[model samples]
Target chain A: MLEKTGLPTDDDLKKVIPDKERLAKGAVVIIECFQKIPCDPCAISCQFGAIKPFKDINDLPQVDFNKCTGCGICISACPGLAIFVIDNNYSENKALIKLPYEMLPLPEKGKEVYALDRAGKIVSKAKVVRVQKIKNKTNIISISVHKNMAMKVRSIKVEDKKNEG
Target chain B: MKKTNLAIIGGGPAGLSAAICAASSGAKITLIDDSLELGGQLIKQTHKFFGSKKQFAGIRGIEIAKNLLQEIKKYKNIELIGNATVTGYYEDGILTIVQGSNGDIFIKLLPDRIIVATGASENMLTFVNNDLPGVYGAGAVQTLMNLYGVVPGNNVLMVGAGNIGLIVSYQLLQAGIKVEAIVEALPRIGGYLVHASKIRRLGVPIYTSHSLKEVYGNDGVEKAVISEINKDFEFIPGTEKELKVDTVCLAVGLSPLSDLLWQAGCQMKYIAELGGYVALRDDHMKSSLDNIYIAGDVAGIEEASSAMLEGKIAGLNAAVSLGYRVDNFLELNRNLRKELEELRANPLSEKVKIGLEKALLKREVDQ
Candidate 1:
């Protein structure tokens, strides 16, 4: 009956190994979660063993910023449309985060767009540093965001976002 | 060709149930399933089922399938052909089953009655990069994890918020995979609120009004991009979200596999609600073509619980129609039918029941 209401939090990583860790000390962390379903690939995908499932497969991945290497392997390994790489060391003051992108009309290398937070809230300006598809016919375009906005921005969108007219 | 008292095709819940009920009535039965194992789709189901006690509520689906198989073993008259595919059907009651290793061994059986519980297949969805290896049908994942003990992918994106999608997402978690999120083009979660709520509390987000635009991967899948869609189902330009993941699982829907019924010359109608083309069948599940019966998912993409009930209905009524004794089987058949009606009464089954009613019209003429 208890299982009917909700899942127990933090039950999946009791004895699990950590896969993702902070390679550079005090590096920023950015996690992109697309939807909610039962899964834990992200928690187990980290080889530095830095990531933790923590409990249920449905739980969101919590990263240890002190140990993250910014390798971005988990960025491509996550299936829920989640995971990203944040480098606070980018530029003079701005942070840079690489995210999974799968849309078309490929954002130009220098194109400017609004960086949005987890709730689609605009955090700051995001310049398209790089955009490329992962493989044959994949819409997953990886995008680079500003260093300062890296921790806050999890998504990208143009102003007055509308279905392609 | 071999002759028998009853011939049941597809050894899933529906077929097995019918075999059990009919065997209890002192009838010899032959059950066939395509999988080397007889449990059918239930084997891929790792979650516990919900329903009344008789329907196996609170029991894991795999355990339920195992229990059903174990019960069938006690029946001396029940013959199960695993790893055999029912290719087609001939006039009267000749079922052509093609066994993989055995080659084409044609068994011409003049059975007193026939029950076709062929079940359903996963509905395919079209999207850019949908054909990638990282993309899979929910059933395929179930097969890999539940049966093979390996995750379909590391991080996964599930498209569709229907019952199948939601249930599979939950099951994927059980197998220790990351379900990034579920994207539903619709405004509301199409599945039960309870299911949605379960995943929601665990921090999995549901992205409504979102549709997949593309998937990126090298040899398999590496990433997915989903964009918000308008009511008309077009991608929104500024609303795109890129998700890095290896696999994209589609649980869009299911459609009935009614080919054998068509081969038997049963009258059919395009009933979209029932998941696809359906063999018009009476309450007893006898199709328009005389001496042929259709039951379970093959009749419509209903749940295993209901399919089992329908199987019993077809088996029992087919027995009576073939001169097994109407007076003796009437009570048992009535109970089975009632159980089916209850299971079909849930709101979740409205679409299926509508399809059943549509299929009933053509069936009435045959009755």
Candidate 2:
């Protein structure tokens, strides 16, 4: 995919790579998590088999960016409250992180939300730019956050979120 | 790809039953199986299964398969393709199957609909010295003795108290092999109490809360070590004991082969109770993909009778997709669902039901 798009590093997901720079050249990393329990779904949910589950099921995911193609497919595949899609290659200092949002009255297009990271830390505010309906009927809301928080924020919480009825 | 009305994979009782069901509906079927002759695991099973009349309970496995095949002979639309192994599956119902019996020739199938009935295989456990040659799967032992008429080993230590282990142990004794003991990791035997009592009557010891810790042998299993566990499943160190044995049989459990469905982009969920990754499907056995259906162990590891019902459902649904509709498939499905629920209600099938519930991951999807 990188070759056709004239990008540098492009490798199949399953094959292992050594250099970190090569891993992140044009990859679109996605981490999908559901619960607060520690998990690494982005690591194990990659179909290209690019990511590896770091240690135990509780470990945080570290993506090999070079192998990712910015595909948001894994956004919904993740069973955990982890996985998000980050595409910094497009748009200025803002990047998109597609995280899972399963609440009813699901976030509408252009709605504002809070972006949270691995430790449920609010790194930055985000806005819903796109809403995705998955095969399993779950909704994923893609949020655009500051480029700095792209790697950290893998999920979103509706502002003043109420329990899903 | 060769297009047929229906393509049934695996030739076990479930597959054959589905074939008969589909063929009865006047749809052409291509029965593809990897073995030279198609009876699947049933060919190695010499024991009779227990179930209701619909399941042909009390009938030997071999005879069940045979009777299903005889019924298939009556269906002119069904085509028998034995010795064929499905290697890969792609979109648009295209199947990449290798015909091993025909000199490794590749057979591409573009059936209007597909039913995967690939059944479960015995699960092997990892323990100290478990790689010993005398250690074998319970199914492997059954295949060896019943099919090849060969004794696996003289004195055997059964590593599980499930139906497979206990039944195979009894079969081993029938073939003149001695069963030293049946050691279970759980405090309770997982199989029917009747089966356990039968083995006990024959002087075979049933050790509950005991687990196989190690085995010793020169080149193959010859001796076994066991330790008892407390209520918490933690082994009691002082309760360790050793027994002289030649062979070890594992009937820990069975895992379904649902990889083909996974490869076909079928939605799957890991419900530990279900044994492994099971494809998500609805009441009609239809998966996320409309044209693709799952049956037998691939749906969720269960008995052949349920698999047969699932197969019938899949085949009938496929027929409906192929322009053949049943008059009252809905009513028949309702009845089938009731029967299946009852069958799964058995003590032996409770785990299987739990697994099925987990596989679906939804409680009320059974409408």
Candidate 3:
């Protein structure tokens, strides 16, 4: 019961991922919402109507990468913090991943930090590129990590505990 | 004796929204809360809420609380009294209360309509050494960390994998506290998959079909013992594992605190879905006894979004009963109910649906 639903499997992740070619072009959204819950902020947040509305309130939100300019509004709009924006064409060897970060002392731009994978384990070193604080104090942070870790890196590790507050 | 058109108990999402609505309807409203600060659980909820824009979706709970407070201030007819505890509801809608920073002052209010939204209390799990100081409820952990900015402990053992349990575990991590494990007695995690995934991605192991056997410590909880359970929920020997931790957070469930409703002589029914014996309410959220209404957790243990919708309905209905006219009242009520149904359409709320059905059936039989 805690299998695919709780921790989504690789197949579940595959179903929600956008086109590989489009993702590599930069600015594509990844929505990991698997359950049929009554939430639609992600759909409404999109100015370009990239996110499709649910026939039923419980239907999972679907994203069209073609229309999705990846304005990153949906990142902070998601209550579950499940939506993310990835730019695979950031640089020659780096890709940028923008994730919803609500923690204190937002990571400093250009500061190198430990990039973590889906399991939160340190996978690679990354540099913070941008931090955007939207409505309700939800911060959207874009970090540059190795191109290979684009999909793997989901969060940045803050080691210094004292600065958290 | 202080007089008002309506009196709302509890300063949570329900009461706050209700007060705002009733005041907007040209009703004199008096909102009372026990806490020095308002917002109930919203004050400690840093996470963004999920719902439509009407319910303030995409907004953090703290911000919603602030907006509600600001909105309430716009109406001069609405008076908010903090640091006030409602002690009793007596004859003819009279309310006995203790109001002061320390509750040293006493007063009685006579209001035409009363809305009880006292909310719910955390259900504690019974195990050896569970009474230790380190064994805290999930709400206590949130209040300590999010509200007071004090981390409960370094290493913690979470008991239950419900929404509250999972959310609190994630929050503890955000507060720099280490959650050793989340043990659930049930065969599966009871919370939403999204919430479970958030903590799982953080490397926190969630153990279903497992129960905490004992919590061992001297002055406080220093360690916890857990074991797997069989179909009958009996402990399976040789499956015991000891986890060294300083805190144990119980997030098993919550029971509605409906003592005020029960004492007010409203007909009560034991509806498990509504979280124990709660006052039976009609479609308008009015109690069996006229002039007494219920909303929020007092009606059932549901989400804050549902509570706000329920509060709006009750507030409008209470205002109407007091001869106050609200524009397009029926239309507004219908829309709120429709939104609530949409929110409860998820499979996770099936139990709540069943409970509500039973309560509605019982109410019909009485009618």
Model 1 chain B weakest lDDT span, ten residues long = B194-203
Tens digits of per-residue lDDT, candidate 1, A3-63, equal 2212222333221213334423333334533233334555555677567544533344667
Those runs of model 3 whose alpha carbons end farther than 4 Å from true positions after fitting are A1-5, A133-135, A161-165, B361-367
Q: Between the candidate structures 2 and 3, which one is better when assessed by TM-score?
A: 3
Q: Say which candidate scores most in DockQ.
A: 3
The superposed Cα distance between candidate 3 and the true structure at residue B327, in angstroms, equals: 1.3
lDDT per residue, candidate 2, B1-367, as tens digits? 5888888988887788788877867888999888876778777765555455566654567787888878888888999887888888886568888886555688788888888888887787878999989989998898899888999999999988876777787688667678898888876676644345445534577787888888998888878998998888777989998999989899898887887888988889887777788888877787887778888877877667677778777777778778786778778768877767666654456666777765552335556
Kindly list the per-residue Cα lDDT of model 3 for residues A1-165, writing each as its tens digit: 334226667788898888788987788899988877778898888998899876767778988889988778988888888888988888998888999887766788888888877766789899989978776666889999888898888877755767657
Which stretches of candidate 2 lie above 4 Å from their native place? A1-165, B101-103, B361-367
What local lDDT score does residue B315 receive in model 3, on the 0 to 100 scale? 94
Interface RMSD of each: 12.8, 25.3, 2.1
TM-score of 3: 0.94
Whichever of 1 and 3 has more TM-score, that candidate is 3
Greater-DockQ candidate between 1 and 2: 1
DockQ of each: 0.02, 0.01, 0.53
